[model samples]
Target: MQDLVNLKVISLFHSENLVRIPELSSATKLELINLAYCRKLLELPSSLQHLEKLTHLNLRWCKNLRFLPSLYKATSLTTLILSDCSNLFSFPEVSPNVRELQLEGTAIEEIPSSVESLCQLISLSMEDCARLKNLPTSICNLRSLEVLSLNYSPNITTFPEMSRNITELNLQATAIEEVPSSIECLSNLCVLNLARCRRLKSVSTSIHKLKSLRGFYLRDCSRLEIFPEILDTLERLRNLDLSGTALKELPSSMENLIGLRQLRLENCESLVCLPESFHKLKSLWFLYVYGCKNLVIWPDNLFSAIGGASLTGRVEMQKDLHGLSSLKELDLSGTNLENLPTTIKQLTRLQKLILWKCERLKSLPELPPSLIHLDAHDCTSLAEVSSITKLFEQALLCKDKPYTPKTLACLFTNCFLLDQKVVASPGTPKLQMLFGHMFTILKDYHQASPQRNMFTTCFPGSEIPEWFDFKSSGSSINIQLPSEWYYNRHSMENFPGFVVSAVVSFQDYFDDAHFHIRCECHLKSCNGDCPNLSCSFTVWSRRGLHGSRLLGSDHLFLLYHNELVRRFVETQASNKCIYKEASFEFYPGVWERNWSQCISCEVKHCGVHLLSAATDDAEVQPPKRYKYVS
Candidate 1:
């Protein structure tokens, strides 16, 4: 092994004091070097490139690292990773054989023409390089390049000429104005994404010549006015996205795209109507027209071809969308729609329906029973809903009035039936179902809850119910009582298994006069079987405001199951202080697995007392303290 100078790995784990690379020029065998989580390391050795055998190098998550080593001498390097090195400002010169490179979340401003020398490079990514502006024209020399991703490159003005071998290319969120004419030279391209390219205005006409193209995405390009006459040339195209574009109408020639499966025109605000020949797209399965405020109807015969003869008997009008039985997901939210086509009931495959912010929608038409997720928030005109029992997993309904007996079977949390009361059905099935719905709501918006308080009394003071008290013991200490809980169940008969309880304690330790509080939590599940519950407790005690006083201990103590898991006892006075009156809300089925599992608790304090110095100035002498406990 002594004679072997070339090695594959040089892994350094948690070696924080290692400041510079050792003189390894004599060992010509280094290929891969991995420096993982070396926090205190500030810079790299300038002689790192002396190793001609080095190839792969990883410097992931080195937070304090500010610069990269010069790589001009390491001609054998092929792969490099500088991911999450937030302070890195530049890249070293690239060698020809380098194929895979990732520099995500760095300050590199451009891909130097020096990279063009890497003729063997295939996959290259510079994602989240916010300040990057250009790719050198020399990039066209990489004949083997296959996948190139430059997403979130905000300042990028142009792409190097397209490489023929490129199969997948992503230029999302860029400032490119048009697809270069040289882009059509790539005959093997399959997927091309220019989504969110706001400055893009036009596409090269040569796009019609790429016969192998299968998918094209052009979403959020608001200034783009016309689609190049390439629709008829894409014989294998399966997905096409012109969503958020300024297109007013589809070209009559678009009827030739017989193989298209997905069409998205969402937020195409100016599109008022569809062409009649749109029905020719027999392969269309997924369609999104949400936010098309001006759109009034589907093209004639559009649904007839998609639903087949099985749905022909279900609808009388060809303009009705209900006959489209093959359709899977529909997002007609925020349209000027008042009444949905009753024929929509035929789309048994529909899984999701987003009707949020549709203020004018008075009611939902009969929907397929197979629906799984429905979001109908802020529909002011909505009053009642008919049978919706099929979508058991999820349902979000923030209605003004609470009408019961429809789908009250699903457990729900954070169900804001404002000013309305809830009446639950008997048995564990209904209880379980009700809790499922409730749990889902709470988990979704728990972070936004203003109270932020984790623990609270179930019935407040003096209102503890009889179920809480064990009949035999005459005390609530045993008998498998449900811990802290939240519910509207008036009796066991209406008890839905959807709600469960857990216990936890919280307190803040003060040096002399410590303040502490503990409580239990009862949560409602949104869906799925409820689990055995536990509680979240926190104790925070500090010396003084901003932790400036030496009289008090500024330590925090947290325990679960009577075992200490976290301690914040400090020896010296710290400037930062913990929040007071910590509060948080827990998910119905999930409890603290560790000290950090608790959600952020909001502190609300009342009953603040002030001490008087005049009453007993001599008697209130300071007391000597020993070991400080967290």
Candidate 2:
């Protein structure tokens, strides 16, 4: 130590064998010392008090360390961290100049009254201090403190008094039963998190005084039955989550939060309905009410009020369901909704609507043209869907204009009622015409941008379509390609691609289960002059088919793969090699650890159809050498 007088920093981080540090008194110029993760170290050298220039010291993860020497004499110290010192029972006196102190994961039972001496402290964290029971009131004297976190302290039953300058306070997973009205003193607070506080019952109405607050989280407060009313407009509040609570209704004044952008009420089973004034939150773009089974009614003018559209009578209720123009996603899964308003199509910007397991919903109205994804899996009572022929007719009307393809996906797994109705009315244009119209739309989109267009659909079925050029009983199929099969010779109006289909069945039921169908392709040239070309693509299911139980039933899965196949063939054209044979293998893939148990999808049948611009009908017949591997 005497030879290192010029040392400005000393770091023995992660030195597991280190038990003691040599006296640092000789290193008078040292400004920082770190001995984090030194598990065997019991105590720091007392000579540390002599370093007047020492400004930072970190002893994090020193599990065996029991006590820290007072740092009162180190006047220059501004940051001190003793986090995860499991054996440490007492708080060490720190210099008043210290700006940050962390004692998280420690054995300290309480903060002493002397803590007021840290008048310059700006941040203090005591999270995961399970033995800690309370904080002294003198802590409010820390006028410079801006952040305080006591999360995961199970024994804490009361909120501590905080300074007026505080900005963020987190008390998650605590035993606190109520938020004291004194919380109003934190006029500058920006965030308040009380999530998972199972014992919490009520919040002070004075919470409205926090005019600067931007986020409030009370999620999983299972015992909480009431929320404080916002006596005044909380214009700055942007996010509020009350999920997994027992609340039955929201105060009508909730509409006063004009800037609110996201609201989550998931799993609030007791919630019956929203206040009539809820429609006034025009800025809200995301609203989730999943699993609120008792929720049955919606304000007649909910959507129209938000969009400033005109409202009409009951006969016109379905006609006036306009507005909510800024909303992009709406989830009403596991609810009691009986039917959707007809004019819901007026929401010109909505992109996704999830209604999984809404068993009471009997039918659907016309959907908005902007919708790109729709999931109605396991909707047993859903017997009719508004005519999709109208949508196709509109597309046909606009065929002369420059095409701009929109990606689309629709899932209807286990929709027995709807499938039974469609099967009974085989001549019905609703479901029967869908395949032809969808194919036409796909062709038009592919002709415009072969590399960017995609379409996917899943519905109840037991066999592959007869139009597919090559068919196989199992999962793999092989076919031969004629020379120049990649392009059409007659005109450049169509682009080359493949339409792949499969009939798959699930062996069992699993919650939140999902799997992807992986297609691995191998292409080889006739003369073996070019190297083998291999590529793969996946067809993913949306939202893990929530609540899906498709046991003993088969579903038809179809999708278009133009980008990969077209790009590969164009690159091969430059090689002047004739690719004559191609083989495709299909298998199920599970990517999530929890979903690994859901790998029971059996591919019963598979088929492939090739599209070429040179062919007048756009369908290329399979060569005589076609082979099938069962």
- On residues 1-630, what C-alpha lDDT tens digit does candidate 2 reach at each position? 467689999899999999988877788899999999999998788878878999999999999999888789898999999999999999888889999999999999999999998989999999999999888989999999999999999988989899999999999999999999998889999999999999999999999899999999999999999877888888898899999999988998887788888898999988866777776887778788888876654566563211111122111122245335667778878876667767678776677788888776777778776676777877778777644534433333333234344455667777766555244456543343455556555555444442344456677777665456678988788877656743333333343467787888766734343556766666666665433334333333544424444455887788665555555555653344556766777776565754242357788888776666555453433333433544
Model 1, span 56-77: residue lDDT tens: 8888767678888777678888
lDDT scores of the candidates, listed in order: 0.53, 0.74
- Cα miss at 333, model 1 (Å)? 1.0
Pairs with steric clashes in candidate 2 = 488-614, 489-614
State candidate 1's TM-score.
0.57
Q: What number of backbone clashes does candidate 1 have, counting pairs of residues 3 or more apart or in separate chains? A: 51
Candidate closest to the true structure, highest TM-score: 2
Residue-level lDDT for 127 in candidate 2: 97
